[model samples]
Target: MATVENRQVVLERYIEGVPKVTDMAMKIGKIELKAPKGSGAFLVKNLYLSCDPYMRGRMRDFHGSYIPPFVPSQPIEGFGVGKVLDSDNPDFKPGDFISGITGWEEYSLIHNTSQLRKIQPDDAIPLSYHLGLLGMPGFTAYVGFYEICSPKKGEYVFVSAASGAVGQLVGQLAKLHGCYAVGSAGSRQKVDLLKNKLGFDEAFNYKEEADLDAALKRYFPEGIDIYFDNVGGEILDAALLNMRIHGRIAVCGMVSLHSISDPKGIHNLYCVVPKRIKMQGFLQSDYLDKFPEFLEHVTKNFKEGKIVYIEDMNDGLESGPAAFVGLFSGQNIGKQVICVARD
Candidate 1:
């Protein structure tokens, strides 16, 4: 069989802090179209790759994380949508469309089919939505709000990093559940997007606020019933001080602490005792069984114009490094995606 050139984004070394484009190097390699014999693997042409905050953890050296860290000199992997080219696995046939953990490369040979999901494309939905709304980020929001937080109607809801991928969906879902929602973003544009476009009850640019606690108080005079904590650090401490009795806090991401060598501890956690708050951390993979229901619910809302998803798309595999780096710098307005190819 003829081999094809594969351009891949490889981790140059174990990163210590926030990942930069220089930490990853693009290389041109070659791959056989066919999966290795008896490898129980499948070959795929990557279409779209997702750039997420959690990927920063993978850039570090392996240290007993829930997911294994990416090895230096190897292709970095993340959630992506792709078209199957060749398969040694019976369940995945040639021409099948799948989405899951894939390398930042033109072509990838996926050995584990367990995480792979077959995509049933619909004209009503964009294929890239699978990497954002209908994919992990959307599912993360759904599970965190509904399952973990157990939100109620008319409650005050707050979302940190509100304009990003997961935060955007969480705010919308809170509104759909009849809650008063407020979101915090890094910039004025994202704040406007949260309030004007995504239907949040209120939104603010955290960077412009001198005191985050004051900002939260301004938005939630009655106190927050459910806080979707995305940024963590000072924001979380502020939310801690502002949480109502029996408030629920769903810890999603700590982007602020990801690059910091010495992470700050949350000091106001003592309030969780007197307030009887339920604060929990979660991974979306914990709620895989709920994906089907989540997909149906989100897809319906999306088609009905009840939910809106924004994406910051970069073109080609070569753009993967910069796109991934942008997540930490808050350069992406919404979901950061790299368009590897169009199927």
Candidate 2:
């Protein structure tokens, strides 16, 4: 097969503070469509790319994190949904759709297939969902709420960044488990969705609150039994003060602090000691064994209309940079994804 041009979203340089679309450049590159013999790799035509809050951590020059920093002048890598075009592995075939770590480009020559999952296309489930609802974000929510928070029936649950990919599901799960669920979002539109669409017991616009602690108190008059912290800092500090005795807190991503070079600490953390709050920070990768269970559970509830997922999609790979940058500012309504190509 003749080599073809692959348009890639490459990191222009290592950046500090909030990321801008300018930090990445769209460069046209070339690749062979065929996977080399005995290489055990597959070649895929990228379809959808995920723009997650966690990717912000990879834009730096740090090396200590679980995932390495994105190489400057190279394609920014993230979870993607793709169709297999060529393969040298027995598990995958030429027509199989896959979801895993893929380059943010038109096509990818994937050598590492460790995290890859063979996607069986369904007319009911949108292909892009593998990058969001059934993807890392959704899995993260399951692990955090069920494993980390250890939620219970009749508990008072709160989720910050409530309209985001992970938070939206966390709030819904809390409600489904017979808990009083409240969520805080950045805008009124999102807050409305939390109440009217996502089925949260109550939703608030955190940006409109004069005092976050007071806002949480208004919503959770009995104190919170579980607090799923997605965006850290101020909201976390507020939730700390509102936690009930023996409450549990799941420290998910600190999307609020990701852009900060020197982030401020929560002053109310001392409340954790007095409240006996079980606070834990976690990564979804820690619970890979539960993936089959997670998939089965979410898929069933989703199909029955007991659960719903929301997404904000950007068409074309050229829109990748702006779509990613939009995540930090609450510009996206739900799961932010870039549609690279249509299958």
**Model 1 per-residue lDDT tens digits across residues 1-343:** 6799999999999988788899999999999999887999999999999998898888888678888889888899999999999999888999999999999999999998778799998999989999999999989999999999998999999999898999999999999999999999999999899989999999999899999999999999999999998888888999999999999999988743556722667789999999999999999899899999999999999999999999999998999999899888899999999999997
lDDT of each: 0.92, 0.92
Report the C-alpha lDDT of model 2 over 1-343, residue by residue, as the tens digit.
Answer: 8799999999999988889999999999999999999999999999999999889889988889898999999999999999999999888899999999999999999999888999999888999999888999999999999999888899999999898999999988888899999999999999999999999999999989999899989999999999999987888899999999999999998743566722566688899788998999999999999999999999999999999999999999999999999988889999999999997
lDDT of 1: 0.92
TM-score of 1: 0.97
Model 1 misplacement above 4 A: 259-264
How far does residue 167 in candidate 2 sit from its true spot (Å)? 0.7
Clashing residue pairs for model 1: none
